[model samples]
Target: MSYGILSKLKLAWTELDNDQKEQLGPYLTFTDYREIWAMGIFLLGATALLPLLIVTIIHYQLIQTSVNSEFILRTERLTSNTRRVVTFFLDERLDALRFTVNEIPYNDLTASDRLSEILSNLKLGFGGLTDLSVIDHKGTQLAYAGPFKLKGKDYSRQPWFIANQKKDSYVSPIFKGYRNVPHIIIAVKSVRSDGTWFILRATLEIKKLMQTLSSYKTGRYADLFLIDRSGVLQTPSEFYGDIYQKLPLETPKYSSRTQAVMTTDAQERHIIMGYAFISAKTTDTPFVLIVVKQKDGMMGVWRRMQANIKWFVGFCILTVIIVITIACTNIVNRLYHADKAKAETMALMEQSCQLAAIGQLSAGVAHEINNPLALISQTAGYIKDLFVIKEQYRNDEELIENIDSIMEAVDRCGRITSQLLGFSRKFDIKTQNVNLKETIFDVLVFHQKEAQYRNLNLSVDVPEDIPDIETDQGKLQQILMNLVNNAFQAIDDGCSLDIHATREGSDFVNIVISDNGCGMPEENLDKIFEPFFTTKARGEGTGLGLPITYGLVKKLNGSISVKSKENEGTTFIVTLPVRIQKEKDGNENSIGG
Candidate 1:
């Protein structure tokens, strides 16, 4: 059903250039008219919004790029600043150790009193120092102060001791050493004139270093921590892992300057990371300083901005579509009305021209046809004269009646043709004594030959009690003639026509003419008497017969109505006044075109 409607609409939308379907926008029905409105809105909406969407997307991408770049740069800058602070913390402690080792005599540095004094001063000055120790050339701890009992401890096989043999100084990563507490060592070597060396080692607790890192500002879900080259956390983390535990993340490759990248954690949360491998100038130890932020948290502002932009764009699109729809509807409505007005004007012009041609044609045809009618009327009159002069034929009542009927028919024909010539002329109402049965019989006389030719059954049911009506005999005759003529045309061979005359009341009478013909559908019954409306094929009818009949009935102050069903039959009922009911100034009445 939908496709069928669409196909018809499509056909209505397109037509040949030579076709006369111009300016008739597919508004055959109200539904088609609304559908056209929808089509216009859809097309115009696409036209208006396509470019808007393209531009919004392009700008969204650009703004996203700018926001992401800003986040990364801010992360790198924070990491770089924090790394400097950490580097300075380690350098200050290491420098204090270096100064103490170079200035003190080896024997004095190894003395318990001297080392004990040094540990006290170091603790008072730097505050994170846990101990001071002296290791001899053989990797034995010769002296120690301020921490656990290690006065004679051996450290020859330790990694830190082994590393000291290769480098001038070292800053060890946080570890649980002999004391079994988290600490970092800053070691310095002192050489004697004999080229044998001993080391001055200072141990710093991890608490102060962890405190330093915690002071930096970060995001809501952010973490700042240090990791070694092997991906081991040196400082405690808020999220990743505790100190000395392996990080559940891929270790970043080393870079001297601070850099940042995005990755996911073991728990599958996205993270933004900034890292710098800080190589303290005074120590060989390097640690990666990383600042990690939740990817969702880091882009909070940008995401909010994106959402706002989307909502704004959506509102704009809706507003534009609404505006376009209203505009298109207004434009289409105006066009439709203008075209309707133009079409009506064109139809009126065409109808006026047709009426003019009909007026001229009727004049010419009436003159030609009236000549034969005049000859027949004259010949019938001369025959009546012969019948009157001869007693043998005059006394024959049937012969007299036949001759009179012939003259009456011929005179009726003459008046009809004359009326066609002046189509707008008012008919004269010649009121006289009208016998209803005799008038109906006289009208049916014209159809007898046709009824006999088609073998049609004709019937009339009129009681003799019907009173004579005082009406225009000529119009009464014509009215009955047209009704009976239509009935004859409607009925097929061997079909039937039924005519009945009955008094409607004391003042009105009804004449009913019915035929068993190919009846009119119910939809067309109302419009059957309208001018230029007919169901007959082209050239078979002029479509003016019933219109004239209806007007003539109205002019006589009567009413006409029809009832029919498809393939059944049609019945026309005419109600006429029983007594003479003249119009105001009846002699001056006219039927307007």
Candidate 2:
């Protein structure tokens, strides 16, 4: 039954022309098992990576936010300290001027000698008084002392002279006055007992003010300077431009207390700046005190920490990928083996059912055909007997030949039916000594036509001295025939099939059937013997040939194994016991018996 189906499939595969083979090439190729493994690994890695990536990004953002907050707080503290020191210095100088004006009378301050003495006293005491001048209510200089030889110089048209006329005392912003140097003025308007008004003016040394401002300990990257309401730099900044240079930053609105803000300078450097407007009751002019620090310098420690965090995250990701790859590979490998075993077990069960059904069907088919076949044989024989009695007709060659042909055809039909019945019959532990050479030759005869049609070369190599084996002849024949037929199906024209048999030790015979044909991939090699698992296209096979052959070999107490490679061909080896052992009354029966 298996032979008939296998023969048909062999014929179909061998009959394919070159063009058909080309068209079917892709379909004939093995499935890409790597694609499955790759997909499994990718899914596993992505599952592990997505959450880690999101968490890492969130952590980085939180760290940056915290660092920025701390940076702003530190900058504000520095700016506040600088503003306090500068305000105190200006207020101290203003107090000195007011004290001198009230102590000396207007008559005494207007005398040149007396005024010079007072100037000397102020210069010694305060150390920043550059020059001194006395002016009356008419805006005329009444007395002058120190530097720039203008004892009678008039301050009537000057802004400071007019400003001091209205206010009792005033402190001017830093400016280049008649002396052509950056200096501030401290002026006091005084009234005598008779209600006569006089003004005392002094030019405050700018260098001393710069020293006082710089006395505050800002960090290395920070700069402290003074800017007037016009946004001009009043003091020389070590980092910013010189005195009187226009500051690049916008002047903030006047605030009694220090105000800190983040900004960028002209060079595009990030900076934190704080400003405060210095105001006093005696002074109408206000000056802005500014402290600036580069943001990068201030946040240097945080930047280092951020870099280290990045490296840590990178190492963690790398480690995770490697771990995921190893873990997923092991898991998928186990699953593949388990699934393959399950599939083979299922296929084996299905094959048993199919074989049982075929056995039943074969019996019914042989019974139904045998009756008509017998009637045809009997009728042909009766006609030959009648012709023999009629001598003249018997001598007629055509008549005799026709009857003989009918009998021969009927005999052929009977042989076919007998073989079918033999295949369907269940044997009960029957064993016989079978010649290895003769058995292989008989199986070859069935495939001779197929081999010739496909232009295949077939050969057998059995040593003449090899001993016969005790096995079921029918089962042995079926096993060899299935393997040869499978080889025929695997190959195209011009391929070869070689069958060889040899003795193994004293107990076993090894039969090898090898073909130079289109081989299978390693992944499917284990499944080739499984039932309903043919690599052939749909409708071309019933997938029962190898499984039935496997069962028959096992019934004879033999094992079969196959080796194959893509485009290289395949070989199947069957190992059977040289002497079959029979059981009788629960004891092993001797071979001689």
Q: Which candidate is the best by TM-score?
A: 2
Kindly give the number of clashing pairs for every candidate: 0, 0
| Model 2, C-alpha of 135: deviation from truth (Å) | 2.5
lDDT (Cα, tens digit) per residue for candidate 2, span 100-175: 7887777788788898998898888878888898888888888888877877777789898887777878888786
RMSD of 1: 11.2
User: How high is the CA lDDT of each candidate model?
Assistant: 0.79, 0.76
The TM-score between candidate 2 and the true structure equals: 0.70
Which pairs clash in model 2?
none
Worst 10 residues of 1 by lDDT: 11-20
Locate the minimum summed-lDDT window of 10 residues in model 2.
584-593
Q: Give residue 454's lDDT in candidate 1 (0 to 100).
A: 87
Model 1 whole-model lDDT (C-alpha atoms): 0.79
lDDT of 2: 0.76
